[model samples]
Target: MNKKTIGRVVKYLKPYIPLIIISLMAAAATTLLSLYVPILAGKAIDLIIAPGIVDLDGISKILIRMIMVILLAALFQWIMNVINNHITYRVVKDIRKKAFDHIQSLPLSYLDTKQYGDFVSRIIADIDQFSDGLLMGFSQFFTGLVMIIGTLCFMFTLNITITLVVVLLTPLSLFVAAFIAKKTYNLFVKQSEKRALLTGMVEEMVGNEKVVQAFSYEDDAIERFDKINDELADVSLKATFFSSLINPSTRFINNLVYAAVGIVGAVFVLKGRITVGQLTCFLSYANQYTKPFNEISGVVTELQNALACAGRVFELIDEEPETPDKENAVVLKDVKGSVMLKDVNFSYVPDKKLIQNLNLLVKPGMRVAIVGPTGCGKSTVINLLMRFYDVNSGSIQVEGNDVRDITRKSLRDNYGMVLQETWLKAASIKENIAYGREATDEEIIAAAKATHAHSFIKRLPNGYDTVLGEDGGSLSQGQKQLLCITRVMLSVPPMLILDEATSSIDTRTELRVQRAFAKLMAGRTSFIVAHRLSTIMEADMILVMKDGNIIEQGNHESLMKLGGFYSDLFNSQYKNV
Candidate 1:
């Protein structure tokens, strides 16, 4: 790409400048030492080939010194390589951690449109491309360049004409590298995208394997997986083939240049200006320079792949999270849990309003039950109350303060929320129940006992310490909901919102949960959202909602006397249960 895009990759390495500088110096020293090896070989050959009366003592000492220098250079090279790996891995680790934290902070809408599998692949496989750049591309490419330049300087001292002929591969190698890099770049990009799609598919299938079995579509699912596998193969094949071109093409070009160097050397020897030893050393320098010629194209290919990954990772890290509190945001003080909505208006999307000009008030310690048909804005009300999404055109106040003025942490901390879906992380039952609240072992047991979950938990092999499977899949739905109830009771916020938390439970468990609810809502302002009217017969203020408007509201007895929407809803309850 352009200079700017390449600059982005350097951003991650800026923090490790000292290590990079040290490594560069070490690499240069190693290249210089390697270049001298051929010269030493040429000199030793001349001493024997010319049949001169050589000084044995001097020659032996020179050989020993040369061998020691070579060993020293190799030791330094190893040290530099170790440092390079350590720094690069640390940088990549930071990139991964920051990206993960940013993704978690993103709004629900951001997650709704993205696939979990695709996100996972980018976080893992895509970042690996950068590892190539760090390990091989930068160090090898720069060190090779230094060796080539240093060899040219030394060879020109012996014979300029011969060195020029051998150095011809330099520009040719560049031409091939540029061409291969361009083509390989596109292939790697395609491979990355296809892999993400494949990852997304794998995640979806694995998460919903139950549904596939229930519908008897196991064969169809395999067929679909095969299609993704083929796409991944096609893209990966193209990238591998294009990247493979670098090695052979570069080697062939280098072999031809070596032959030219040999021919040039023969001509120089006939002129008798340089000794056999000098020509051999010159040839060795050219050979050392040309070896890296084959390596350049491979480095370019690696660089292209790394940049592709850089773009993906940077895109994720740059995503802005949902709106946080403003500067000097007011904190709601000593909230007595009096909630009010004045002319409230909201929509998940801008075009269709789910709650239109709605108004309601929940006094401190009042039990309000919100009832509506599915998607009639019942859950949206809870979403607004929790400030997951802000109201578009109205004010929702807690106590005497507007929700917008308070920090989200403080606002959420004031309310205990239990959603219909019980998402229990794979952890010990005690840890799951005490989540978001710092509680002692005694408090944890009390919360579980309060929800009637402790009785069953004690019967497990490990009791409270038993590890739950993924998403608590090992537990029955009723048990999962009981765990959720216990989770909220432990937090014990001043206000509680239960949006069908008992919906998936058995009738027997539901009755127990109702008792837990009674304890939880004792002195707290609570919102009980229920589809079944029989479940909420004891609600102090039963508000009936239809078409985004509250048509009737009163105590169960008072609403039944009115013979309105609540009465019709109560009458239909027998048909369902």
Candidate 2:
């Protein structure tokens, strides 16, 4: 067992110390009462000296006392179980909540590299495994220890020779159980890892089932799933096979000790060193003493698996969160939306440069359109501007202050963003439109009308009150885009980012929405990224980017006259027209 991991798991028990103390006390009581019953039974047996001379009254009294002790032992055992369950589940709950909260604080770069399904398995499946292990340890492990110690004390009071024999043979059982447990731990860890991989693959395939079917990738998907499933089965079988060896292996050793005690005590009885009744008590204590070894061996097996699961959960909780904001960071307010990027360098991966020493300046209320082929770093520019990623070198400034110098929340509050892909939660239309802000029904309707979504919305059974499913279920791509557009129309932030925002809408609806966008963009600084050349013809300035550099810059007429890259791009789009 890892001492460090065990220590960390123990730390969660600090809050429940009082309950743990009470439970331990109950375990002690239960074990003591249970151990005393054997002594009472031996005394009742001693009362029957001969068939005709048996003391019925004394035997009857001892039997009554034994029954009372047994009942009290059972009651304490019940209390311990209830308390153990409470502590185990509460600890698991705390660990899960901490892991989930830490995931939210983790950097986007870190999240991008992880599998969503694996995270789900860690929070749900792994934690549940940890919970089971913890509960078993709490319920059985400590009680077994107490039983072993208590039985030993009772046996020593009867005879020293038999006690020594049992003690001498006990280490064999311990060594056997320990050896098997060490072998199973790593196998259990591998099993958990493979299970997570399988979960991630299943989630990915199911979530994109449409794409899988469209590409006829069913056979390939099944092949990949089988590969992971086979690996999981291999590790799980090894772990189960190793852990299963602990029980019978230890039981065989314990039985040897039991037989040794019975032989030694019987010899002592024959020589009159102890009576037959006393020999009977020694035999019962011998069985009681060795029985805990078998139970504890089982507990050890469960604990090994639990600790393995816990280690995975703790790894997530301990991940480094996104860098914290500076203590004296400025809060952006009353933003004029003048933006500047000077000598900026950035790359998603080190040693593979994407944008380098890029420089640009946009005055307040200027409409800047960035046109480029795919993978030319157009959306990346928006990412840097929004501080989703910081530039590797140089600086980006809003108004006159460096973006890093301003609080992220305050900086983002001044901008409205709409992407080609739309997002909607499982909620009513009114709730979705009013997300992140308070708005009246009147304001929601007006914004929806402006984006040309109010017509279809009213056609629904509940209109604004209609509760949509996850990601706007059954809504056409165009309808979803309009709802996203309505979100920005309601707020009308001082700055805007539109990355192919109307690509999903029909031409007629796109024309109507473009008029609405022109009205919305009249006095706001906007960065529009569009593949369609016609949409950005009226931009105050157009920048044509190639391989992360601005190859051409001018208005529509000037760029057309320059007859360079921008001219060719525009002409290509209108060639068919």
- Pairs clashing in candidate 1? none
Q: lDDT of all predictions, in order shown?
A: 0.83, 0.92
User: Which portions of model 1 miss their true places by more than 4 Å?
Assistant: 51-59
Query: Candidate 2: misplaced stretches above 4 Å?
Result: 52-54
- Encode model 2's per-residue lDDT on 1-577: one tens digit a residue: 7677799998998999999999999998999999898888888888888879999999889988998999999999999999999999999999999999999888777888999999998999999999999998999898888889988888888888889999999999999999989999998889889999999999999978999999999999999999999999999999999999999999999889989988888888889999888888888888888888998999998899899989899889889988778999999989998999999999899988888888999999999999989988999999899988888999999999999999989988899999998999999999999886899999999999999899999999999999999889889989999999999999889999999999999999999999999999998999999999889999999989888888889899999999999999988988989
lDDT of 1 by residue, 1-577 (tens): 4356577667878999899888888888898888777777777767774456776776787799799989989987998888888887888898888888888788776777889887798789888777776577656887777777888887887788887787665678767767777788777777788888888888888988889899998999899989988988998888888888887887888878888888778787898877788877876776787877767667777777777776777787788798878888788767788999999988877787678889998899999999978888888889889988788898999987788888888988999988888899999998899888889999999999888898999998999999999889579877888898899989989999999988988888788879878878988999989997778888889888887888888999999899888887788877555
lDDT of 2: 0.92
